[model samples]
Target: MEERRRYRRLPIKLELEINSLFKQNNDIIKLNNKTIEVIDISKNGIGIMCSDNFPVNYYFNAKIEFDEERYFYCVVKIIRSSKQGNKYCLGCEFVGLADFLADKVDEYEELLNKSQIY
Candidate 1:
């Protein structure tokens, strides 16, 4: 497959609760008691694994904790998904995420690079 992503993905696992999830039909869903694990992050999007399936183009809001003290409350749109074993692995893109927060992600990536971590 051709690499068309504008930014590189950084491996960063963060668990966050879904405040709300909106389906394409404008229905609201609450995925409680299930941990939505953000497995990877980039300036434009994130890769997440969860027990529940997120339909493509559906949106969800959550507060993603980048670190112990840093958090980003943002809306994400599920762009793609696949069933990985018993888990639903989905790729999501930030919707209207601020540039500063994206910069923060870049900074984290640079730090990981310096540390020789992928």
Candidate 2:
């Protein structure tokens, strides 16, 4: 028998900024700066490809904009990371997300569904 994953993934294509900080719950941290391309995004979290290495237990703030009109801020915790060619794959769990950002994620998922990209 083959194992099946429980969580459903939605396709996302967006550019995001990662700014790591030493303190938690604060958006003032700027440990390392990098630009990552989001591969997938959900209400709970996001996955992206980056070139830098972020140590575990690191907390950071992310700014993602789907379009010129839509943008959001999220506090993210690095859950898992791996290297794929020249880019590193990162799975981050969202923290302290506001209702507005959650709504935007839902909207993006719905758009992906209608476009048949899921």
The lDDT values for all models are 0.85, 0.74
Give candidate 2's TM-score. Answer: 0.75
RMSD to truth, every model:
1.8, 3.3
After TM-score superposition, what is the CA distance of residue 40 in candidate 1 from its true location, in Å? 0.6
Clashes of 2: 0
Candidate 2 residue lDDT tens string, 3-118 = 45344557778776665545464435564557778888777788888787666556677777777777787788888889899888988878888878778877777777788876
- Using all chains and alpha carbons, the TM-scores for the candidates as numbered come to 0.87, 0.75
TM-score of 1: 0.87
The sequence of per-residue lDDT tens digits that candidate 1 reaches over residues 33-71 is 457898999889999998878778889877777676666
Q: Show pairs that collide, candidate 2.
A: none
Compute the lDDT of residue 96 as modeled in candidate 2: 83
For this target, which candidate reaches the highest lDDT against the unseen true structure?
1
Q: How far off is residue 99 in model 2, in Å?
A: 3.8
